[model samples]
Target: MDQSISSLHMRKLCPNLEREDALDTVLEVPLPEEMFPNRKGGSSSSSTDQDNHYAWLKSQAFNKATDTPPPMLSGRTAELQLLLSVIGSPLIPMPVPFDTAFSNRSVCESSIQASTAKYILQQYIAATGGQAALTSVQSMYVVGKVRMSSSEFHMGNDNSSAAAAVPPSITRNGKSEIGGFVLWQKNPELWFFELIMAGCKMSAGCNGKLAWRQSCSEKSHASRGPPRPLRRSLQGLDPRSTANLFVDAVCIGEKIINDEECFILKLEVSPNVLKSRSASSFDIIRHTVWGYFSQRTGLLMQLEDSHLLRMKSGCSRISASTQISCKSINNDSSIFWETFMESIIDDYRYIDGINIAHNGRTVVTLFRYGEGSINHKRRLEECWTIEEADFNLHGLAMDSFLPPSDLKVDCD
Candidate 1:
């Protein structure tokens, strides 16, 4: 995706460059021999190079026996899984004095609402299955089915003619891939999640001290922030963990969701937390989450979150006067991308005295905007239905939660 985006930028920047020259400048590779073969005076060496290039391209496109997933589809699958894993996930916040007040009383009333949030959480705990029952559980296992679909994308920045000429790939109103996941969790930060869809697999887990994720498109990499809870926990699979997650959240008031009165608990990641997750070239500007708890049933009915990120990239500019002399243009300015996700939970079923949402739907939107790019948006939706669930699994162990040895662990 990055490479493709880079190519688009190059095309815009150097429209006058020949196609072969453009490929050479951007990809640092000669244009494909199929499209631009050597001419008349070409030597045997050039012919040999062409033959080798074609062979390499064929090899990349044709390995029938290998289990490696197709690059395009695999990349998309991995991307979808990454989006699902962090939909409404948040970082733990440091507690503040309840008596503290800010100049903007209405905007920063979290301190005053802390107690109310706690009381609401207690009610939630009691409603799910009292604290005693929740604390007694040490492990859990769940299996669920999901259907995911993505819509074709277009940028308003693109010309109307180009937009009209672009064939539709997929739409929000199109077919979806059906798949399922198996999840295992142990007390105090030990958990494993595996999702399989469209013949591609993605897995993530926590080994108490470290959290990591892996997929067909990428090697496993340790998470950036202090080990966060697995996204599955918020799906009503682990009431205890879910309760603890919002312990520091503030009651933002009540709202009617799906005809049911619900209390909204809101939590925003602190700047420090966002800083920890940011890379040198990318900044996580903001991440905020909200959970809607049913006032009548004291059950979680919906979860929503939004995140904003800014990334900076630099590209070189080639001069028409001297193709040999290239100048680095800070033209790679900062671009902001945002993602918003909302999940609606329903069909709650009692499993071992605990309320588990057997059916749910999640919709995610990714918006690309900021410097030099037109606002482009794409949407993905996933509906999940639980098929099986069991608590206190007997044989789940720390060994099963260990990060893969082949994975590279990011520095704290």
Candidate 2:
């Protein structure tokens, strides 16, 4: 064979061999018997056949071992692209107000006038009933509902998980039966709440005699429990009780400023009372300020309350201001407020009179603090209304509302 062609053939036969390495490695002798130890050959024809077979085998082995290509990563690359697209997409917006009237207040007296606490309380009182009528009622039955929303925000700390996990905002609708009993010289009152929501029900009833709770639900059978100490301390449904618990805390006083009627109240909650009420679970110290307003008419114009509650883990502060101006006294109005509460705030509204007083909005902001530079905050806005209200003069039985003896299982 020509020298160049022979070299090319040798290259093909030994693909891994290079010019420098080939000269020292290629053998000039005939095929060795050890290279084909398994071959059975002795005649001349078999010898020729073995040589050709060895050449072909060498070519096949060289191509298999030396010509293998690098792996293709197309599938892995595509998967990575898909993951990026999903992670980069826009997230669902939180349930916050896009526009609010209070957001644009300027630094002026009018701004202060609208947001003060005293204005908010008066509106709330008038919405329920006039001061005289509210005071006149010996007992009251308030049926309402409450809804809560929760969201997780990044703690932005090393100790936290790479992704923050937050419980889904659960909207719970339930019926709450509240009874206010007269206490303390017909001024203060005792209050009870029987709430059924999301298949979980808790009922609390208290008077000067006793305070108790009963939980009834599908997951847990009806059971009696102990009453919260604060509930026990509450005086009966009278102005004196109301004055002590509410009015005393938030100093209730009337004022007529520039013909625009306003009620100023300062609230100071006792830490000792909160600790006693919380028992062993949580320690809370709460203080509040209220502002109520009326435009000469008995109707409440607006009500606002600013509250601050401190605990061991952190603090929760809220400013709940409600404006109850437009008064439509009719069955439909009451129904509208009740329906609103069911849909947005609470699950139940007890029928009161033709007037509905529970239509209001609440904005709450929660914060969690940590040792490092870790802080989490959340804001929730809700619109609520009360539908039905009645008077519960027949006091609830104490034994009927106590926790069941079987519920001693450790809930913690």
Candidate 3:
């Protein structure tokens, strides 16, 4: 299962990007070779660089690997893992809120905060082409390019041993590696996502009942808790799904984003969902989301997702992002990791009567704390722009969103 989506394959799945009505944007989704540069002093080609690194890692090094993961072979590995933990398994607000709202429009009329959010959501729906246009859409295929990088984990105390485990090569300065992604969606619950970068790739999908994620380095694994829409879809790719996400949300306040005053609607992931995602390795503390809708445009300008989970005592393990779950010597006290992710959605332009967000940036910050006063902070970032979008595909089928056949239950 190579799982790489070629441009030709994408072109066949969706409408032409060069249509007479196409926007000015070229939406270049270049091949990986052109996307990620050589870490081998720019002499070897990307494929050669990748093959050489794979050889080096597999030769004698990978065979005698230690608990501490490799820092960086070149142009990235450690950072790739950080991405796999975050972007590879990204999730949006679930779509269950609509049931209560549609069943009874005044379901939560007693709460002012809830009522205010409903008002904001209505305006948002109208701004993104209204309920009529949104409902007409059945499926979508989105292609886009992205640049990503991660910062080294900074320790507040003298944790030299832990620092050694996280190699310095994993950190990028300002420049980041380029990558591309392809997403096919039938709805919030049924969708497929794939992203390739830095000689690493990841894919995840949900078949309306089960969700699973896989990467170049790891086996396919189930996502914990209830199924949720891909976070990328909410970056203005799917307005209907976004509206469904905030159906029962409450508007607490307003803020200015990108110089635009916006109303903020917030929602907390229910306790049942949190408990479902919990496992023997860790317990999810909270997963909250806040959407900022621009007052002038009435469209969502930004989204912020904050998540917290603590590793259970007596359990020693590391996550895809090794820095996120550093192994502790003492098992008596649990180590807590808080991840704050924010996406500033912008560059909205209509494609086939649907206003889709053409550009956006996502920033993820991770904080780790536990016994021995251990504290650390790390950041990962991604900037993406859509190249093309086609909706209501002719051959789109439910089989496309099926979970991997070899999917293993998530251990965390």
Question: Which structure among the candidates has the greatest TM-score?
Answer: 3
lDDT accuracy of residue 248 in candidate 3 = 71
Where is model 2 more than 4 Å wrong at Cα? 1-136, 145-148, 151-162, 165-190, 207-244, 249-263, 274-282, 289-291, 295-356, 380-382, 392-412
Give the RMSD in angstroms, all C-alphas superposed, for model 2: 36.0
Two-way lDDT contest, 1 vs 2, winner: 1
Candidate 3, after superposition: displacement of residue 112 in Å?
Answer: 1.0
lDDT of 1: 0.59
lDDT of 1 by residue, 358-386 (tens): 98888878776654444567777888888
Q: Tell me the TM-score of model 1.
A: 0.70
Preferred candidate (TM-score higher): 1 or 2 = 1
Q: Candidate 3 clashing pairs?
A: 27-387
In the predicted model 1, the residue pairs found to clash are none
* Model 1 deviation from the true structure expressed as Cα RMSD, one decimal place: 17.5
Q: What lDDT score belongs to each candidate, Candidate 1 first?
A: 0.59, 0.28, 0.69
Worst ten in a row by lDDT for model 2: 335-344
Model 2 scores a TM of 0.40
Model 3 per-residue lDDT at 222: 71
